[model samples]
Target: MSDGTLRLLLPRFLRRFPADLAAIVLLVLATGVATLAPVISETPLRVVLGLVFALFAPGYAFIAALFPERGPAFDGASASATADEDERSGSNLVERDESADAHTGLTERADPRRAGSIDGIERVALSFGLSIAITPLIGLVLNFTPFGIRLVPIVLSIGGFTLLASAVAALRRQALPVEERFEVPYRAWVGAARAELFEPETRLDAVLNVVLVVSLLLAVSSVGYAVMVPKSGESFSEFYLLTENESGALVADDYPQNFTVGQSQPLTIGIGNHEHEQAEYSVVAELQRVSIRNNSTTVRERQELDRFSRTVPANESANWTHDVTPSMTGERLRLVYLLYRGSPPAEPTIENAYRETHLWVNVSS
Candidate 1:
């Protein structure tokens, strides 16, 4: 916290500047973008960015931490060449009587398990595979927690894991010698890609490069267009009725079977809007006297009880309580609810209602 403490820590922090700082910075940026983008606006950019971050970054950081040493790069074709190069390099060292003993001592000091260490290509491939494996495992673990696999918990868990792994990787890399640390030579890769794309040798190669660039551009444009302008799906609404349980939770059970005239019963009405836009809805509650003969029912009389309206946004729901008071006494009376998209007609019948629900009850005077 003090100036002297800050000065002492600053040098140590910078003493071994991380070679993979760009990757860590990207992971942090992606986490922030995924977290804030949806709150700011609904866009597919966040989905794409978040998908890449979730499917790659965490595993890559974990792999980096596990393998901080740059493994030997040798293939079948280059084995002989690498051996000859090593022989030539060894010829320059000073000759001494203890050279054999020194070689044996060095070999004994080296870790034999490191002989199976992986190179950059294997690390990258394993990073992607392990990410796919690890992400679902994290979700599975979260399913049992209080969070129950929600967005905020998932993001925090993954983001925190990635950051911790990146820190561990940095520390591990710093512990190794500078030349032995595993680092991504992104600058060199960029330079090589630029040269391959723009600085071709022959006319044929230049023409091929141009074609490749155009193809890449077209592919990117197509994917971006699809993501930005997606087609709308089916639009509909849901209407349901519920009653309060002993736990104060709304459930579709325990309806009042018998109701006295002028007495009130409590019930809940719920609506879910998936219309892809804000919607204004009207609900009409009524009690009807019906005569049933040979399983054919006919409404003899209808009495309107209550009317309610709600304005709900897309992909949202609304719930409200309504009291049902019967003024007419009858046996097996139908307590009906009619839902309309807008204002209901003078006669809101079941045939014309957008949605309808009813419960048969007995009313006594």
Candidate 2:
């Protein structure tokens, strides 16, 4: 491809600005990491990158767009002009002390407004604040949309906003004069940091710097560990039986109380997987003939009706309809469902099953 075509293909904001390019790259990385984190590695890289992207990137880009020109504190050109004028005035005052009028005129002519505009510190604080405010607003808007506030929607919306804001910031910066544009002093910061750590004036100073660095690293490690490897909650699964109502909705109340021999009756069995992983379940339906003496019940005989197996995802529910036909006629027959996490043993009983539910019904021939 031609050089111009390649340049044209790239974003306009990224063409000439290193800061914008870096911001765009970081945003893309964060988005990709977050979107693919579940499918990719189990490392805490996603949390780290996602936190930065969610908390800081959007606000910083927005602030940059709003204030493309260098802040008052870093307006070197304006500071230089004022410094030059002061120097000239001081020299004039030194040379012409005999003339009170000349000295007074120099003092009055000096610029009074020393502060130029918002500085680096304010910009940073504002960026954080704006980001915190903007992100939730984006989420709120997404709640109203068809996509809702899901992972993909949230990531894409925030990332899209950040990208657009960064582009606007870059364009605004480009419009400003070269000297007036706000630029992150990456090289200056690195040089200063290097000097502070490597070229400490005394042994104590060096030792203190090392301690500070270590403390920062420890703090970061602690946070990463906490976020990356969270404690697991109580693992459990929900098992229930449901019956279709007159309105065709599944309800727990309309259970079948009577069954005919060789006649199928519809019953819905549901399994909610809360085990934090995919689980395969085996459900065994049995028609039990039992004898009740006082409060104690003993099974005389049991007939297996149907067997069902299902694999359910974590935090999801699976429902299946089964037709229960009693092979033996009896009064107060126990229609039992035994749910096992894995393959059921040779004899599946209520006590052996991971979950168990039963209904009392009478069978007629």
Residue-wise C-alpha lDDT for candidate 1, range 1-365, written one tens digit per residue: 88567656766665455747546657657666756775633677676777777888888888988888766552322344544665887743346548656754754454222455677679879889988988899899999997888877888788778888888888888887765677666675798799988888899999999899899999999989978887779999999999999989789999888999898998899999999999999999999998889998888999999998999988889999999999989899999999999899998989999999999999999
RMSD, each candidate, Å? 6.0, 6.3
Q: Lowest summed lDDT over 10 consecutive residues: which window, candidate 1? A: 74-83
lDDT of all predictions:
0.81, 0.82
What does candidate 2's lDDT look like per residue over 1-365, in tens digits? 99778877878745686565476557766667765777653566676777778888889888888888777665554556555777886755556667656646754553222334467899889989998999999999999998988878898888888888887887887787776677777776798799999999999999999999999999988997898787779999999999999988789997989888999989999999999889999999999998889998888999998887999998889998998878899899999999999999999988899999999999999
Worst 10 residues of 2 by lDDT: 107-116
Tell me how candidate 1 scores on lDDT: 0.81
Error in Å for residue 267 of model 1: 3.1
Clashing pairs in 1: none
Steric collisions counted per model:
0, 1
Q: Once superposed on the true structure, which residue ranges of model 2 sit more than 4 Å away at CA?
A: 1-13, 17-21, 37-41, 76-118, 129-149, 227-229, 240-272, 276-278, 287-303, 313-336, 357-365
- List TM-scores for all candidates, in order: 0.75, 0.68
